[model samples]
Target: MADITIRLYIGPSSSDLRELVVPAERPLGDLIIDWKKVYLLAEQDSQGEMIRYQLYRESEGKKVPVDPKKSLRDLRFQAYQELFLTDACHPWWQGTTSQPTTTSQSKAPGTAPLRGPATSKRVTTATTPNPSPSSRPLPSFSPCSIELAPGCVRQIGETGVVINRDYLLRELPKSVSTLERTLMWMRQESRLLAVSRSDNGHCSIVWKQSWYLMAHHPVYISGTKYSRNEAIQIEETVTLLLGRDGWPITIRLHSTSITR
Candidate 1:
C-alpha cells in the first residue's frame, strides 16, 4: 500500500494538529510508538518508564478510541481523514510528580485505561467540541430515505437504512443518502463490487456476502414485490457475476419492485 498523509492531532487543541505521512499498511499501534519518541513526557518518570497514550478519532459526534491493532487501510481511511494520536500525560495537561505508578486501572469511571504507567495525579483533559447540528452540508437533490413503516416499532437504525453502519436516516430523507449508506453496508458485509438503481425507487442489492440467495419468483426487494421483466422466467435462476467468494452477486429485477 502507498503512504498516505493524514491530519494528526497530538493534543486536544487545534494547535496540536500536524500533517504526518504514515504507511497505509501499518497497524495503528505504530503511531503510538512514534509518539513516545517525540513527546517529552514519554521520558521515564521516577518509577521508571510510565505514561500511556492512544489514538482516537471522531465518530458520530464522539471521540472514540481507535483499535491500535487495525491498520489504516483496514479502516478504509481516506487521505483527508484525520486522526487523534493523543498524549494523556503531556505537561500542558499533567499536574503532578508525586509518585510514578503502573496499573491498568482507570482513575475514574467512563475513561480509557492508561496506556503506560502513571501516578495518582488526576487531571481532566479537554474534550473536543461537538460540531453544530447544521454542520453537514445542505442537500441538493430529490430527497429519499427510510422511515418507520407505517406503525412498525423499528429501533432507529435497525431498518435497512443502515445495513452495516450504526447510523440511520430519516424516512424519505434523500435517495442519494440511502444509496450511499446501502453501498457502505454492502461493503462491510460482503464482496460487493457494484450497485445500480433502476428507473424505479427499488435498488438491486447484489453482493457475495451470501451463499445462494434463491428466492421464489416475485421476490420482495426493499419491501416491494417484483417479477422478472427480462426474458428469464420464474423457473430460471439468474446469476450475478464476478465472484471472489462465490456466485449470486448480480440481479436483474426491474420497475415492478417500486411502489408507483
Candidate 2:
C-alpha cells in the first residue's frame, strides 16, 4: 500500500507540527507510540508516570476522535490531512486535569493576567484563580470569531496587531515578504500543560502550562484559511513573540484541524 500523508500536530500549538508520510499497515495506536520515540523525547515520563493522549481526524468540518486500535487502512486513510494529538486528560483549552487540581493564587483583582502558561503548581486560565504578583502581565488579548472556511472554528486570541485572513496560511498573497512580516507582527505562544497522569490530585505545571489555547489557524485575527507554506511563519512569529512583553506581547496559536 502507498504511504499516507499527514500533518501531525503533537500539541495544539503549531511549534510541534510535522508532516509525516507513513505506511498504512499498522494500527494507529502502535504508530503513535513509535512516533513519540522518533520525534518527541522531551515528554519522557518519569517512573510510573502515565501521559494520556488523544487523536482526532478532521473530516467534514468536525473533529472526530480516532480509535487508535484501528488501522489507517481500515479507516480508509487519505493523503495530506491534518491530525491533532492532544492531552486527553488535560485539555489545552482548559489547562487543567479532568480531576481539577487547585493551585493557590493571590486573591487580588487585576493582580494577574487571566491568560498565560501554568507554573509548577498552577494552571492559569479564565477558569483558574488569580495568579501571584510575581507572575508577569500578559499582552492584552483581543479575541474575535469568524467563518468562511469549514472545519475551523476554535478561537485563538491576538497579541499586537491582527492580520486579515488574506495573510493567513491560505492562498498566497502578492508578496511573500508581506506575508512574513504580517506573521512576524502576529504573536503566538506555547500552552504546554504540566499535569502528571501518574496520579490524580497531584497535578502541577511542567514546561509550564498556559492559560490560552487560541484555536489559532482557523480563527486568527479574523477570517479565512492558512496555506501550509505560510506555516513556518507561524513558528518564527511564535518564537519571536514568546518572551516579548513590550508593545506587542506574544501570541498563542491554538488551531483546530481543518478538513480538506
Candidate 3:
C-alpha cells in the first residue's frame, strides 16, 4: 500500500497552511506526534498538570473530533482533506474535557491569534448566586469558512488560493500568475465551488477540498459531486493544461487504494 496526503491549517487563517504526507495505515496519534515535532511542541507536562492533545476533522462545515487510535483510511479521510490543530485547553474550544489547564512557560510554537470556539458549564458556589465573570464562557469565534479575496483573486505562490468556478471561468481575467492555472486545476478536480460572481466577485470554496486537490491526483468520485459530462470536460482540461510546457509549477501526487 502507498501513502496518503492531507493538509493542516494551523488555524482559521489560510496563511499558515502546511502539507503532510504519511502512510495511509498510520494511526492518527502518530500523525499528531509528527505535528508536535514539526511545530516543536514540548511533551513535558504543562505547569504542574499533564497536557493532552485532541485532533479534529472539519467535515460538512463542522469540526468533528478525531480519535487518535483511528487510521486515516479507517476514518475515510479523503485526499486533499484539511484538519485544524488547536490546543484542547483553549477557552473557546468546544472540545474542552475539563477546566482549562495552564501550559508551561514555553508556549506552543504555532500560537493562535486568539482563544477559539465556545461551550458552557455550570458552577455552584456555596454563597454566590451568579457565576463570576472570569468563569463565564468566551464568545464564539467566526464559524469556520473558506477565506477568499475580492475581484480577480490573486494566488499566493506557496499557498494557492481557491476560487469559485463561475468567477474563474467568466470574471477572472487571463493572467500569467498562478491564479488562472490554479483556478483551472481546481475546477478540473471539482474542488472549485461554483457561485454567482457578484459585485465583489469574492466567494468561498471548501478549504479542505481545495488543498486536497493541490496535494493529490484525485481519482475517487466520492470527494466530488459532478455530472458525467463535467467529469469528461475536467479530464480534457487537465490534458490540455498538462500538454503545454513552461507552466513552471510543482505539485505533489499521492497513491490510491480501494477500501473494503
Top model number, TM-score: 2
Put down candidate 3 lDDT per residue, 148-231, tens digits, no spaces: 223433333223333333544543445523465576667653223323233422222112111222211222222232221111
Off by over 4 Å in 1: 43-49, 87-122, 125-260
User: Against the true structure, what is every candidate's RMSD?
Assistant: 19.5, 20.7, 18.0
User: Tens digits of per-residue lDDT for model 1 on 198-217?
Assistant: 33212222111111122222
In TM-score terms, candidate 1 sits at 0.34
Candidate 1: pairs in clash: 51-117, 52-116, 144-174, 144-175, 145-172, 145-173, 146-171, 147-171, 240-250
**Each model's total of backbone clashes:** 9, 18, 3
Tens digit per residue, CA lDDT, model 2, 152-203: 3334433222333322333223363354445556743211111111221111
Pairwise TM-score winner, candidates 1 and 2:
2
Off by over 4 Å in 2: 41-49, 93-122, 128-260
- Judge candidate 3 at residue 154 and give its lDDT: 35
Give candidate 2's root-mean-square deviation (CA, Å). 20.7
Give me the displacement of residue 67 in model 1, in angstroms.
1.4
Candidate 3, residue 116: how far the Cα is off, in Å:
17
Cα misplacement distance, residue 120 of candidate 1 (Å) = 12
